[model samples]
Target: MKTIALLVVLTVVAADIEFYKTANDNYDIKALIANATELQAFLDCFQDRAPCSELTASYKKNIPEAVVQACKKCNPSQKHMFRQFLEGVKKVVPKEYNEFRQKFDPENKYFDALEKELSKF
Candidate 1:
């Protein structure tokens, strides 16, 4: 009976686990950042100034939850990649970075907390 109860608890715990999609994890963020056109596409997509590809759309859809939750669902690699991406964007394209902040964090409620969380990884 104890063994059965343990199995049930383990199953429940496993079922509760959640994570963000990893399909785009392997994309070369550094290359994307270095390319002006590709970077602008991402910016336009996020800002709704242009249509988004399926991949970018997925990210755009999740940005709010990811920010508010401090990327709790993100895996370690994602955390590192995101940190790099954010830093790169801030440094390489300050104007677009601000636009992204305005779009995603309009009231300025979450960027600082998000930055704090990202810095952890």
Candidate 2:
């Protein structure tokens, strides 16, 4: 019971921090999945075997841990499909947006951080 409560408190605090940091919609789980969809597609394009073909399909069938974390941070209704166009623009955008090109994705910061933090759980 105590462990569960601690987890909850940690989650709330994390959410608050994200909200304060982003000052934008805290991406929900589905949105995280959407982001994964984008990632899968990109990977598929780069790899000779086409990672997107497998990655996107896998996400549609089974949600990833990153997606679940995103869902926890934001509301369910906020979920949206990931767009390749937005991702493309991110490449040319200023470094501030890229945050040292962390993960080579600007919008993925939340999902990335969530995945890292949740790994311990």
Candidate 3:
């Protein structure tokens, strides 16, 4: 019985660690994508062209690791929202998207694999 209880606890802990903390999950990604001004702000923030909001800063901090890991820590909604945001950026502002790619993926290492994996989500 003690062994079973320990196994259960470990399983729960492992599950919790499998994804990133969800605090920012409720942020309105769709709205940000739809509003050109807001979208530009996010791009500017990430590209170091402007100051970042607390939330944007937090996201910028995690973005590289998230991309390298193929968003393994993202929950389903986050995965979907990220895909939506990427598609929106690439479609709406190709130049800025290229700039973003250059900034974040300077060596051209991660984005292709990340996008391929994200497409599966």
Candidate 4:
């Protein structure tokens, strides 16, 4: 029974990793949002802050530690997708992006940081 349980756990973990990889490869918006939300949650993981759950997906219960690493591996494609997504968001709902930008990073520091990282690709 222990061996069976271990196998089941391992399978679930493997499937999760595989799903992240596939999502990274495809630049799926849901996956991107999940990662972004997780990252934001981590950033605001402080004493007086509430979690920014609005940006997160319901199905993603926890943050994947390797999301950024996976993103880096597919930087070229992911960067393009990210830029396109941002542009689309601005076009479709200008106010929403502005509000999100202010809420997540008021000074635009995160955007600058991302720009630096994505430039390396």
Which candidate has the highest TM-score of all?
A: 1
What TM value does model 1 have? 0.81
Quote the lDDT for 87 in model 4. Answer: 53
At residue 40, candidate 3 shows an lDDT of 97
lDDT of 1 by residue, 27-99 (tens): 7888989998998898899889999998888677878788878887877777777787788899999988898
Model 2 misplaced stretches (Cα beyond 4 Å) = 1-42, 45-56, 60-105
Estimate every model's Cα lDDT from 0 to 1.
Answer: 0.84, 0.40, 0.82, 0.46
Taking the tens digit of each residue's C-alpha lDDT, what string does model 2 give over 1-121? 9999999999988777431112223334334335655544444443323534543443332223234455353332223222222243344334422442343334554655543443333
Estimate the TM-score of every prediction. Answer: 0.81, 0.23, 0.79, 0.38
- Any runs in candidate 3 off by more than 4 Å, and if so which? 1-18
The lowest-lDDT stretch of 10 consecutive residues in candidate 3 is: 17-26
Quote the RMSD, in angstroms, for model 4.
12.0
Which model is ahead, 2 or 4, in terms of TM-score?
A: 4
Model 4 clashing residue pairs (backbone):
none
Q: How many clashing pairs in candidate 4? A: 0
